[model samples]
Target chain A: MELLLFNIFNGFIIGIFYALMALGLSMILGLNGIINFSHGGFLALGAYMAYSLAPAIGFWGALIVSPFLAGFVGLIVERVLIRPLYGRDPLFSLLLTFGLAMIMQDLIRTFWGATGLPFEVPNALTHPLSQVYFFITGYRVFLVALALLATASLFALLKFTRVGIRIRAGNADLEMVSALGINIYRLRAVNFSLGIFMAGLAGVLAAGRLGLTPTMGASLIMPSFVAIIVGGVGSLVGSLLGGIIIGVAAGITTTYYPAASDVVIYLIMAVVLIVRPRGLMGQEGLLE
Target chain B: MKSAASRHVDAAKPADAMSSQKSTRRRVAASALVWALLLTAPYWLPLTGGYTDLGSRVLVFSLAALGLNLLLGFTGGLSFGHAAYFGLGAYGTGLMLKFVTHSTPLALLAGVALGGLGATLFGPVTVRRRGIYFAMITIAIGQMFYFVAVRWNSLTGGEDGLTGFERTNIHFGHAILNLHNSTIFYYFTLFFFAIGCAVVWSVLRSPLGHTFVAIRENQKRLRFLGVSVGFYLWIAFAISGFIAALAGALYALLNNFTSPEDLNWVLSGDFVIICVLGGMRTFWGPLVGSVIYVVVQDYLSSITVNWMSFIGAIFVLAVLFFPWGLLGFFQRRIQK
Candidate 1:
C-alpha cells in the first residue's frame, strides 16, 4: 500500500511537470503555428540560470528571476530569428527551432559543464512530512503547490486579462484579428515570451527535483510532446490532463515492469491517435 | 558544377525546338560528366584530401535524403520518422550477418524487407494527418522503435549497439568480387545508388508520380477529381521507406555495425535538412546537399569539438538566407 501510494504521489508530481512543459509548448504551437523545438532549450536555460543566480540572489530569488530572463531571451529570439518565417511554411520554423535547440544545449554544456550539478534547496524543505510516507518531502509539497498556483494563475490570466483575451481571439482566427487592426506581430512576440516564461518556470522546478544537466531538457521534452498530443493540441486543459495521466501511468508501470515504462507512454499515444485523433480536447480541423 | 551551369543555360534559353534540343544535349552531357566524376573519384579524391570511404558516405546520405524527398518534396507529405525505416534496415542487415546468414545478397534483401514492411504497416495509421501533425505523429511512432531497440538488449545489443557484422565477398561462377577493397566497396555502394536514382527518376516520370505532385499542389482538387489521395500518399510513403532502408542497409555494411542512433529523430531531422539545404524541388538536390553537408561535417569535426553548434548555425542560416538552396537559387537567378 505504501509503495502504491508513493508511486501515485510521485506520478502526480511528475504529471504536473509534464503538464507545465506541455502547456508552454502548446501555447507556442497555438499562437505561432510553429512547433517550438527550442522550448526544451528554454526550459534548460531557465534551470541553469537559476543554478547560476542561486548563489547571488538566493534560491527563492533565483526561482522568481530566472523565468523572466528566459522570457526576455525568448522575445529577442522571436523578433530576430523567428519573425521572418511567420508567413511562410511552418517547416522553416521547425528547422530553425531545432537548430536553436542544438545551439542552446551546446552553449549550456559550455557554460555549466557537461556533468550534472546538484541544485540545493532550502533546508526547511528537505525533511520528510510523515514517517509512513517518507517520500513526500517538504520540498516536494512546496514544488507541487507552486506548480498548482502557477497553473491556476495562468488559466486566470488567459480568462481575464486583456492580452489573454486577444491571444485567445488571435488563435481562433488570425486573419479576422488582423482584419480588426490588431498588431499580431507584437501579440506573437508577447505570446512567445509568455510560453518561454512557463518553460523557464518548469525548468526551475524540475531542476529542484531532477538536478541540472545540459541534456536533461531533451529527455523530458519528448514526454511533454506526448502529453500535448494525448491532451489534444490547442487545448490547455487537455494538455494538463494528458500530462498527469501519462505520468501516473508511467509511475505505476515502473513498479512492476520498469523496462516497459517509456514505451507505455508511446503506446498510449498510438492508442489515442487511433481512437481520438484530435486528442481529448482538441478542436477538429485546427491543425488538419 | 557543370550541371549547375547548364541548368542555368536551360532556364535562360527559349522553349523553342532549337533551344529544347540544346537543353537535352546539355542535360545528357552533364549526366555523363557526373558519372565520369564518380567513376574516377577513387583515383582523384586523394589529391583533394578525401578518400573513397568519404565518397561512399556522401552517396549513402544522398540516397537517404533522396528517399525522404520522394515523400516530402514530390508528394507533399512531410514525414520526420524515416529514420525508423533506415534503422530497421541497418539492424536487419547487421542481425543477418551476425546470426542468420553470411551471404551479402540475402542480408541486403532481409534488411530492405524489414524496414519496408515496417513502413507499410505504419503508413496507413499516419496518412490521415497532414502537415506538422503528420510530422509529429511520425516522430512519436519512430521513437517507439528507438525505445524498443534500446530496451531489447539481447536482440539489439542495447546501448553498446550491435556489432560483429561484416560484408562478405560475392562470388559469381568463377569470378570473385572482394569487397574488402575500399574502392570496390565504393563502387558497390554506387551501384545501389544508381538503382535508387533510376527508381526515383522512373517514378517521377510516371502517371502515379503526376498524381502525387497534384496532391502536393492541391489535395482538394485531386479529391474532387475522384482520386484517393490517402492511398497514393501511402504508396509514396512505402516506396520512400524501401529506398531509405536500402540506404541504411548499405550504411550498416559500410560501418559493419548498427545502433539505435540511426533511428533517432535527430537523424530524421538531418535527412529533412539535407532535402531543404540542396533544393527540395530539384531531382539532384539531395546529391548537392549530401556532398556539401558530408564534406563540411568531415572537415569541421576534424578541427573542432564545437562542430554541432556550427552545424546548428548552418541550419538557422540556411532557413533564413538560403531557403531556395544552391540549385534553386541558381534556377531563380536564371528565371529572373
Candidate 2:
C-alpha cells in the first residue's frame, strides 16, 4: 500500500511536469505556428542555468530567476533565428527548430559535460513531513504547491491582463488582431518567451527531482507531445488534463507491471485516438 | 532518380514541348551520369577514400527518404515517426536471421513485412489529423516502439544492441552470389534500390499518386469533390512505411547489427531533413540529400566531437537559405 501510494504521488507530480511542458508547447503551436522542437532545449537551458546560479544566489533565488534568464535567451533566439521563417511554410520552422534542438543539446553537453549534475534543494524542504506517509517529503509538497501557484497565476494573468488577452486574441485570429493595431510580431515574441518561461520553470523543477542531464529534456519532451495529443491539440486545459491522467495511469502501471509503463502511456493515446479522435477538448478542423 | 520512362512522359507535356524536350534531355543525361557513377562506385570509391559499403549505406538512406517523401514531399503528410518502421524492419531482419534462419531472402522478407505491417496498422490513426498533429502522433508512436525495444531486453539484446546475425551468400544452384563480398552486396542493394525508385516513380505518375498529390494541394477541395482523402493518406502512409522498412532491412544487411537507435525519432528527423534538404519535390532529392548528409556526417563525426553542432548548423542554414533544396534551386534556375 505504501509502495502504491508512493508511486501514485510520484506519478501525480510527473503529470504536473508534463502539463507544464504540454501547456507551453501548445501555446507556441497555437500562436507561433510551429511545434518548437527546441522547447526541450530551452528547458535544459533553464535547468542548467539554475544549476550554475544556485551556489552563488542560493536555491530559492536560482529557482525564481533561471526561468527568466532562459526566457531572455528564448527572446533573442526568436528574434534572430526564428523570425525569418514566419509567413513561410511551417515545414521550414519544423526543420529549423529540430536543428535548434540538436544545437542546444550539443551546446549544453559541451558546457556542462555529458555527466549528470545533481540539483540541491533547500535543507528545510528535505525532511518528510509525516512518518506514516514517508514519501511525502517537504520538497515534494513544496514542488506541488509551487507548481499550483505558478499555474494559477498564469491563468489569472491570462484572464485579467491586457497582454495576456492580446496573446489569446492573437491565437484565435492573428489577422484580426493585427488589424486591431496590436503588433502581432511583438505579441508572438512575447507569447513565445512566455511559453519558454514555463518550459524553463518546468526544467528547474524537473532538475530538482530527476537531476540534470542533456538528454533529460529530450526524453521528457516526447511525453509532453503525447500529453498534448491525448489531451487534444489546440486545447490548453486538455493538455493539462491529459498530462495528469497519463502520469497517474503510468504510476498505477508501475505498481503491477514495470516494463510496460512507458508503452502504456502511448497505448492510452492510441485508445484515446480511437475513441475520441478530436481529443478530449480539441475542436475539429482547427489544424486542417 | 525516378524511372527514366516516367520523366520522359512528364517532359512530353503539351504546354511547351520545346522546353520540355530540353528538360527531358538534360534530366536523362543527368540520370545516365548518376547511374554510371553508381555502377563504378566500387572501382572509384577506394581511390576517393570511400568504400562500397558507404555507397550502399547512402542507397539505404536514399531509399528510406524516398519512401518518406511519398507521404511528406508528395502526399503532404509530414510524418516524423518513420524511423519506427525502418527500425522495425531492421529488428525483424536481425531477429529472423539470429533466431530462425540462415536464409538471407527469408530474413529480408520478414523484415519488410514486420516494418510495413506497423505502418499499415497505425497509418489510419494518424491520417485523421494533419500537419504538426500528424507529425507529433507519429513521433509519439515511434517512441513507443523505441521504448519497447529498450525494455524488452531479453529478446532485443537491450541497450547493447542485437548482434550475432550475418548476411549469407545467395545460392543460384551452380553459382553462389557471395554477399560476403562488399561489392556484390552493393550491387544487390542497388538492385533493390532501383526497384524502389521504379515503384515510387510509377506510383507518382499513376492515378493513385495523382490523387495523393491532389489531397496535398487542397484537402478540403478534394473532400468537396467526394474523394476519400483520409483513405488515400492511409495508402500513402502504408506504401512509404514499406519503403522505409525495405531500406531498414538493407541497412541491417549492410551492418549485420540492429538497435533501438534504428527506430529512434532522431533518425526519423534525419530522414525528413534529408528529404527537405535535397528538395522534397524532386524525384532524386533523397539521393542527393543522402549523399551530402551521409558524406558530411561520415567526415564530421571522424574529426570533431561536436559534429552534432555542425549538423545542426547545416540544418539551420539549409532551412534559411536553401529552402528550395540544391536540386530544386538548380531546376528553378533552369526554368527561369
- Backbone clash total for model 1 is 0
Candidate 1 residue-wise lDDT, B167-241, digit = tens: 999999999999888999999999999999999989988999888877777788788999999999999999999
DockQ of 1: 0.50
Q: Compare the candidates by TM-score and give the number of the best one.
A: 2
TM-score of 2: 0.97
**Residue A52 lDDT in model 1?**
95
Report DockQ per prediction, comma-separated: 0.50, 0.57
lDDT of 2 by residue, B152-234 (tens): 99999977789999999989999999999999999999998999999999999899999987777677789999999999999
Model 2 agreement with the true structure over A230-285: per-residue lDDT tens digits: 99988898998999999989998899999998899999999999999888889776
Q: Where does the lowest 10-residue lDDT sum fall in candidate 2 chain B?
A: B1-10
Best of the candidates, DockQ? 2
TM-score of chain B of 2: 0.95
Question: What C-alpha lDDT, on a 0 to 100 scale, does residue A282 get in candidate 2?
Answer: 90
Clashes of 2: 0
